[model samples]
Target: MRAPYASDPATARGRRVPEDESSFRSCFQRDRDRIIHASAFRRLKHKTQVFVEHEGDYYRTRLTHSIEVAQVARTISGALHLNAELTEAVALAHDLGHPPFGHTGEDALEKMMAPYGGFDHNAQAIKIVTSLERHYAGFDGLNLTWETLEGIAKHNGPVTGDLPHALADYNALHDLELDTHASAEAQVAALSDDIAYNNHDLHDGLRAGLFSEDEIAALPMVGPAYAEVDRVHPGLDSYRRRHEALRRVFGVMVSDVIETSRALLDDAGATSVADIRHVGRPVIRFSDPVWAELREIRQFLFTRMYRAPSVMKIRAEVTEVVEELFVLFLGRPDLLPKHWARAVSAAGGDKLLLARMVSDYIAGMTDRFALQEHARLIGDG
Candidate 1:
């Protein structure tokens, strides 16, 4: 029942380690299940999206953000007659490699690991699935369908130039067509990420008291949505007013993506999944007007919330933790966990390889774990 251009699991480029097809599940379904059960997926529950994990119970974690993205992706994919399951799979796995404390943690890791094939979460996600997840007896990683790996590797777009070393190494072993775009489902997942984060961050930022309703009232689409909600529900409680307005904003984004993508799909005349890859531009996107409005909303959030003094204070503290931990592990590789220690030892005193292993260990840590590790190792606990 898939649309002509939908990624059909029946003809999926099979896993690296070949195996018999599942009797009950499509390849994408199996991919989703495997991702759900991964150790990295479980770690997401305590990983920060914007707010630190210990900041509040209400803020979204990487786990919840991934779920929200999956929901948005499924909705858009279903509307477009695309493979919703594959879209969901990609969405769920999209943030698997984000370090603790949101982008702050990633920034620290990237800086610390700059000498050793710099850290990119997208590339780290591919590394996690293709080599880090050692579960199955026959394979070290999930051995996901080729499409799933491609989506994880290139969901944003093509990797046409110098690549993250992790991605480049894996691409050498099993080509992910680094020069081309991922499937349409991946494009949906990527856009869904945008819709979910922008909307939810606005909600979280408001709830955190980083900005007031009046402050955001001058922003683009968000301002109009808030005004409309207030007009419809005069004197509504602050909570409900905020909820109504944000939900409208979310709906606007979804509607824009669906409407714009539908037109693009029709125009492209792409009758198969391969046709999507060669379209040379993403078919999933918001209209120009909506995209500009979203940019304004993002600017508002950036000034009022993301870079707010309160948040940046914590960002500085967490960045210090990541940097110290990287130095600690690099200086004393034996301090890493047993398996990580073995890998460091296997590196045979190659400082660069050992640094990369330390990067992997730290990048895998949850916010709480990273903080605790920093304390325990650096004598602040």
Candidate 2:
């Protein structure tokens, strides 16, 4: 049984483009299913998370990372008696806007499109569900429910400042209430993302030899987890040792969030999803100690893994690919895919509109496809 404050599908705000309810699925379940089947969702398979897609099979691609986030989200939401389906839907769709080479591609796209309204993955995600993912004959986008759209728009927190153009455009048509906290389920999904990425990056970095067990041994949560693994399994193989240690660290983080959130919810006394949203503070979060320790861990990964020499070299190369593709498409829209070219031509000589279309086309590419297109159009030699 869910808590009183849980988002009830019966009271859901409903989708922008109305449709008949499914007999077997809750509205949120249908949302999750639609997101799973989206072409953009499938493209995440080859998009990088930390390591490039071609680096190794063990590294987390965007698709794997999203799946992990969903797993964590469901676990947290289920424990909190929140809507696990809505949380999973948000988690799965969160990274759909991430371009070819993860953050590198996003940064490059932001730079290239600075004059045409900056690119933001969060806002791009909102755009994708509302206008870009044209799966239905009646609508341009998926026409997801309001709660899901709000979760996608402000899952990180309230958007009080100038919104991204993509988000702004949609908000004009149907306001997502960007200036308040999301549902508890959405809050759970957001924190779950933090838990998944921080833990997975440590595991991936260890496997990549970007950093050693010794390197992470001093970090908070890492130290105790490793010490326990060593105490229990002396002289274990490197693979098993790393796995055991990281799993312990992951457990600690998850436990911290759940315990902290439970206390916060009790204090807030929110009796409905609206009450949870308007409470003026997040109901889901890590404890103060855990948050600080996570900051240290993130700094370690940023310095030793994200900015390592090998990763930086690839970052530079992929940034160039994104920039060149953006400029090439802007200069010669005719070179875009036939369907994209038709869309550009239909813009009726609006360069800004053409640029935005090019941005969408380029942002949807997979890493391998982006590299191939770069070589094909700009030539590797």
Candidate 3:
């Protein structure tokens, strides 16, 4: 049974553009299906997670990371007796706005767009769903339910202060209660993202030779996991040993969130979704001990993996790719695909509008497609 605070599809606030309800699926399920089929979601197959798309077939791309996140979200939501469908929908759609080379691409775009209201992946995600997607016959975008949209926009926490332009524009049309916390399902998705990345980055870092098993084996949560695995399965091969220890580490994080959040929810006395929103703080989170340990793990990864010499070299190269592409597209709007012509014409020589149009085009590109365009347009091949 779902918790009283869980979002109910029957009570969903409905989509911006009303449509007949699905006979077999709940509204949140439909939202999940739509997100899965989106063109933006498909492009994640070639978008970077930690490594560039062509770096190796083994590294996780945005697509795989999203899938893993959804899995973790489902597990946590189910354990918490929350609405798993809504949680899964938010998890699956969370990274839809990430550009070609991951953070490197986003950083370059943010610099280029500083004058044009800045660039935020969270806000861009709202933009992509609300306006950029033009597949449906009746609407410009997927027309997801208000609940799903809220989960997507505020999954991290309440939005206050200066809102991202993309989110602001959409909020004006339909109020998303920007100053309030999102539902517990959304909170579950956010924490699931944390668990998924922390676990997988270790796996990927090991695979990339940025660090070794012994190096990580000395870390807080990681050390105990390795010791436990060795006790249970002595003389295990290196590959199996690494996998066993990491899976235990993953389990520990999941269990910690489930236990911690459950206590917080019970203590908050929240009996409805509204109570969850107005509860003044996030109920889903790792235990304080786990949070501190995770920090140590993150710091280790930040220094040893994310900022290693080889990775820094690649970051610089990809940053150049995103920067040059923005410049090229802004100056030569005519080089944009024919489908973008209408939007370009609509810009009517307004620099901000034209630059935003260019930003959308480049932000949607896959890593391979961005590289291909760079070579074709700038003769950089």
Candidate 4:
């Protein structure tokens, strides 16, 4: 049997989402099915999570990341006795907001649209569910439940020191029912994102030779983890060859969350983000030691994988391409999509709306599309 918290109905603080299945799946599972079938989810296969979309045959694409998140969240949720359906749905849709080319595209577009309303993948994901991509109901978007929308927003939320989005700020309305339903699942999704990416990014970096097994072992808790990795699969660990190593890493993530939550259940009401606080992070979280190690690994990745000469060669080139293309499109102004000019909510008239619209459009483009457009307009034979 599942843990007893599966039926929890707390508040936005940490609660169980009510669900009723029709003939097959529970409501949240149905939501997951709809997301899986959506064009947006399919498009994620070709989108970026960290690296360029399609740049490497073995790199994790956005779709793989989403699937992995779902797996991690589901396992964690099960262990914690949270509603698995809600956890899985939240994990699957959390990154639906990210634009192509990962943060590279997100940043370029954010700058271009700063005048209108700075672009953000989270807000954009909400927009996609609420209004974009018209389908059968004569509605462009998916019409996801309010609970799902709230989970998407609170997944990572407005990071520290950042202003909230207009939607979040102006319509910060809190519906008790939706709040009660979204809390646990949202946390599961958020924590899963961290857990999945941290471990996988490390493995990916190691495979890329951005760092050696020995180098990673020298960083933070990486020594023991690297030893565990080697012990799990002692052979050469290439992206193509480390199949067993990859599975071991995934297993570590599942066990970490499960054991961490079980250990912290007594701290369910801790006071602060730093207070050795609540079990399960009130949403998605890990134990103190696990989190500390992940943080150090994150710092190391920034220095090794991201700032290395090889990755910089691509980042420098992509940064130029993204910024140049944004300027060109914003300069022309008329290239704005017809829907954007007409349907936008901004009252600053067509020009402002067009800029935001252009940013969204560019942000939405896949790495290949962005590159092709940039080359067509800026590159010479």
Q: How many residue-pair clashes does candidate 2 contain?
A: 0
- The C-alpha stretches of model 4 lying farther than 4 A from their native spots are 1-23, 157-166, 169-182, 225-249, 263-266, 269-283, 336-349
Number of backbone collisions per candidate, in order?
0, 0, 0, 5
**Tens digits of lDDT, candidate 1, 60-176:** 999999999999999999999999989999999999989888899999999998888899999999999998999889998889999999999999999877788889999999999
What is the Cα-based lDDT of residue 82 in candidate 4? 69
All candidates' TM-scores? 0.98, 0.98, 0.99, 0.80
C-alpha lDDT of candidate 1 relative to the true structure: 0.92
User: Can you write out model 2's per-residue Cα lDDT over 1-381, one digit (the tens) per residue?
Assistant: 999999989889999989999999999999999999999999999998977788898899999999999999999999999999999999999999888899999999999888988899999998898888987999988888999988988899999787778988999999889999999999998999999999999988888999889889899999999899999999999889989999999999999999999999999998999999899999999999999999999999999999999999999999989999998989889898886766876887798898889899999999999989999999974
Clashing pairs in 3: none
The window of 10 residues in a row where model 1 has the poorest summed lDDT is 336-345
Per-residue lDDT over 155-214 for candidate 3, one digit per residue giving the tens place of the 0 to 100 score: 999999888788999999999998999999999999999999999999999999999999
- Give model 4's TM-score versus the native structure: 0.80
Candidate maximizing TM-score = 3
> What range of 10 consecutive residues in model 4 has the weakest lDDT sum?
7-16
What TM-score does candidate 3 get on C-alpha atoms? 0.99
Best by lDDT: 3
